[model samples]
Target: MELSEISKSEIEQEIQQSFEGLVEASKALDATRYFEFIDAERFVGLNADGTNWNSIVGLRELVEPGFNAVEKVESLIFTNVRISVIDLNTAILVNEYEQKILLKGGTHYKEAGGGTQVWSKASGKWLLVSISASSKP
Candidate 1:
């Protein structure tokens, strides 16, 4: 698709939908589905607001433990999102969100946070290139 044909609103909506899909995959403990949206070879993740970024191998390793730790996703909301398209193939997305999760062994918690993600379109598919998220209790 041409950059002139795409609107900022459209990219924003796509990112929002993809983020929700990630949450759903997490809630279901479906690693395969979760990885579908990720660009594993070029992935970079800053999970839980951590300073050090995780590479593809680290990201993969976290899938089982991360989802296994979450029994259910009680609530997941993303808001105040902004999308800036650098080109037809690249965009930067920023957003704030809050989530309530039920963890394994009956632990429950609520977290609020914001994130910045760099998305790239390759072969007509939008793939997550890098992301950094910070959350508070």
Candidate 2:
């Protein structure tokens, strides 16, 4: 659908709901659901400095490691989300999130970051095509 034809309010709602789905998928480590918000055929991710993940399917492999690493975390929380719809088919979402990770010996680490997701409409659903994040310094 063209951006001009879609309502801004509707687009904003879709973006917000899509991000919530992403958070749920992350906390559950459900790759299937995670991929649901992504356009598997055209998804692309870039880290800071413009380095690509090398391949679309490579996302699963990269995220799997982090999922395993966070398995011990006691909790993950997403907060302070702000979403802006650039157009009907695109949006930029920013959010601050924290995770409380527990390790052996009662050690704990709190990780936080600001994330950006670029969403696009494909096949009648919003799919996240690009994502980038930076640690809170």
RMSD of 1: 2.6
Q: What is the per-residue lDDT of model 1 for residues 1-137, given as tens digits with 9 covering 90 to 100?
A: 55654476677677668777876886677988988878877788787647545677777776677777888889878767777887767888888888888988999988899988888877477878888878755
TM for candidate 1 is 0.82
Candidate with the greatest TM-score versus the true structure: 1
- Candidate 2's C-alpha runs over 4 A off are 1-6, 48-50, 103-107
Best by lDDT: 1
| TM-score to true structure, per model | 0.82, 0.80
Q: Taking the tens digit of each residue's C-alpha lDDT, what string does model 2 give over 1-137?
A: 54553487778887888888888888787777887888777777776445676556677777766566554757788778887887766788877888887655566788787778888886678988888767775
